[model samples]
Target: MVHIQHKVKAFIKLGSFLKEYCEYSKKPIDLVGINGSNLAQFHEKVTLATHKNGWFSQENINFSLLQWSELLTENNLDEWLGNYNLAANNYKTVAIIMAGNIPLVGFHDFLSVILTGNSALIKQSSNDDVLLPFLADYLIQSDPSFKDNILFTEGKLENYDAVIATGSNNTARYFEHYLGKKPNIIRKNRNSIAVLTGNESTDELHALGEDIFQYYGLGCRSVSKIFVPVGYNFDTFFKAIYSYHPIIHRNKYANNYDYNKAVYLMSEFKIFDNEFLILKEDEGYASPIATLFYEFYSDKTALLEKLKQDEEKLQCVVSDWPEMKTVAFGSTQKPSLADYADGLDTVDFLLKT
Candidate 1:
């Protein structure tokens, strides 16, 4: 088995390559010791990814790359892995069934599997099939040992010891039925919510817009619903998010906006519209694209209690409320390595398996 430090070093090198690639536009002449041909190949792959999935816009893909580049630092990796013992007498093959909702959505699971000295058998969602294999190639180039550790399959997954599968509530049931016999993490649907007090500054609300609109609101961490005080004026909130108006120009997003708006209007549901976004009083957590669901709360205690009761359905809570755990405004997508999805510790799970 490859040593844990060797695996960490390979990831750090990959991070360095990603950092340079994200900044490549600023320094066109300097390859910065990165393989020039490989850099070109990665750019081509990014273009191919966009062509394959309209939702994977160039800007969103770059944002994901920059985030990973920043996160894969030695300090961050060390701090995240320090809590667990990584030594193993034998390595296991872990199967990862990925989701394609956003770019690199399954990367954290893949990373956890590799870092724990296990082989990864990845079955990628067809919507996001281009990028991760290219990244795995980069890791293998950095250290040839990774070539044996990573495998991608288009057929049925077999010969794996454990599984980590992510999907919608329906698909999750399917996954549990087929893969549940193994040690597994079957993740289902989860959405994020924001709590807004009337006193939020324009800047805070503006930041919240990032949490809502980034990744075109496709990520599980994206805030799909908001809780506000009764009779809260929304003028400030509207103005703060007005900067994201250009998002409506994207054809796919515009199509969703127009379609959902028509359906809402035909159904005689009262909705607040600004031509680009529709705000409806919805108790549901998962809002359709280009729409935001909202509810009014009268008592903070009761709201917290309700939220606590529904914790399993939530991926994040964007708020500054001191009584409960909260993610800062606009920072839901920028989770740390330790921020496990569904509040389940992946590394710990893998270590035990």
Candidate 2:
């Protein structure tokens, strides 16, 4: 078995390659090496990915790589693993079914499986596919020992001892029927939301705009809805979010906005139509692209209680309230490695299994 230290070093080297990749992807620079292999393949993968999936924009892909570059460091890795004894008495082949909403959304699970000495069978999402394979390639290049441990599949998953699948609520039903017997972690539809106190600073609301618009509200961590006090003025909020007005220029986003806005008008649904974003009074957690659902909360205590009760449906709660388990504004999508999806720890689960 490959020692854990070797695996960590390989990932750390991959991180260095990623930083250089992001830099060169923006403006061509001198190529560097990972284990003596120049990362020209990194640029090739990014081009193919953006063409294959239009939603996987270069900026978004680079953002994911930048975050991973920061995360796959020695100190961060040590601190994240300090709480667990990673000795694997029994190793299992864990199948990872990834989601493509955001770039490299499934890398954390892939990292967990390998770091715990378990073999990984990854089925990449067709939407955001190319980045992870090249990453896995870098791992193999950094350490030849990883060749047998990391695998990517395009067919039906087979011969896996455990599973980790992420998808919509409808797809989760199918996952439950098929993989329920295995030691598994199945995730379903969950969205992040923001709570407003009406006294928030301009900087805080500006940060909240990033939460609402980053990745075009495609990731589960993006804030789709907001809770505000009764009779709260949205003019202030709108002024703060004016910086992101360029989102309206994107053809795909513009189409959604125009289509949804026309539908609301035809149906006589009263909505606040900002040129870039629409505000509608809705009770649901999930909001469509270019639209934000707002719910009026009269009491903070009651709202907190309800949020606690309905926690399973939430990926994150962005708020200025320091007392709650709420993340700060603009930070729902910037979670640390320990911030697991569905509030379940993947590494611990893999180690125990």
Candidate 3:
């Protein structure tokens, strides 16, 4: 435990140094033990992929960078570090089975583990292979001491003090079967929701659109369903989100939009459409395409009852209504460092021996 405390302090110092480098250079420091040319290529990939409209939308790109900077800054990381009490904790390694729902979704977990004096044995998601290593390169360059603590592997992970696994509901069964004996944080598929009272302004509704469609509706944090008044006007809501039309025009996104549209039509599903968006009433929260999913309700009490029935499957809920604290909107597209999950701090999960 004493050793872990020393190591975490060192890591905080390292975080501080790397943050200074990023702010001063305005270039991500991916140059370390690896080749300089390769680092350049990786940075180029990040820039091109983010800037190009074909791969990601403008709002998505902007928000992605916003989160990257948030995680890289000294002020944010320091606040995150202060939130933990690592004095009497010790751990050798923390195995992370990361999810690939959005770009760099695993980054927060990685930072938490490393900063809490635990070595990370990462089993990278096929969907998110690039981000972790890119971050590791910068950390390794900022301070050589970090190289020993981070290991990327496809090999078996056992005898670790703790594990953090993120997957779908079906995969949670497998994670439990294999890792049931160890202290673990196993995350299942959970969708976010939004609650709208009739009092929302136009700006508030437009901002909510960013939360719903920023990652093309692929992220688990993305709002998959909106609870609205039964008599809500589809025209007013769609108009607020019409600015995102260019995003739907991308080939990959358009393909999803077209395919889902076809399925809705073929099934003779009832849908309301204007020039900007589609309004469909569905039972499930998750949607198959890049569309805003919704469920209209006549009464708030009934909606609350329905939400309670599926509380275990929900990750976060957003609302203009004040009763739900787990809910957020608009400016909260990038969550702060304090947002814990499964009722546990990730850094604490890592540091517990």
Clashing pairs in 1: none
Q: Is candidate 1 or candidate 2 better by lDDT?
A: 1
lDDT of 3 by residue, 72-109 (tens): 55566667777667664575788889886666677777
Query: Which candidate has the top score in lDDT?
Result: 1
lDDT of 3 at 153: 90
The residue-by-residue lDDT of candidate 1 on 114-144, one tens digit each, is: 9999999999999999999999999998889
Q: What local lDDT does model 2 show for residue 227? A: 95
Model 1 is weakest, by summed lDDT over 10 consecutive residues, at: 25-34
Across 1-353, the per-residue lDDT of candidate 2 in tens digits comes to 34988998888888887887777777765554542245566777888998898777788888888989999889988888777888753788999999999999999999889888889999988997788887887788779989988888999999999999999999899999998899999999999999998999999999999899888899999999999999999999999999999989877889999999998889998899779999999999999999999999998889989999889999999886976788988787788989999999998889888
Q: Show model 2 residue runs off by greater than 4 Å.
A: 29-37
Ten contiguous residues minimizing lDDT sum, candidate 2? 29-38
Candidates ranked, most accurate by lDDT first:
1, 2, 3
lDDT of each: 0.92, 0.88, 0.70
Lowest-sum lDDT 10-residue window in model 3:
16-25
Q: TM-score for all predictions?
A: 0.97, 0.96, 0.85
Q: How far is candidate 2 from the true structure (C-alpha RMSD, Å)?
A: 1.6
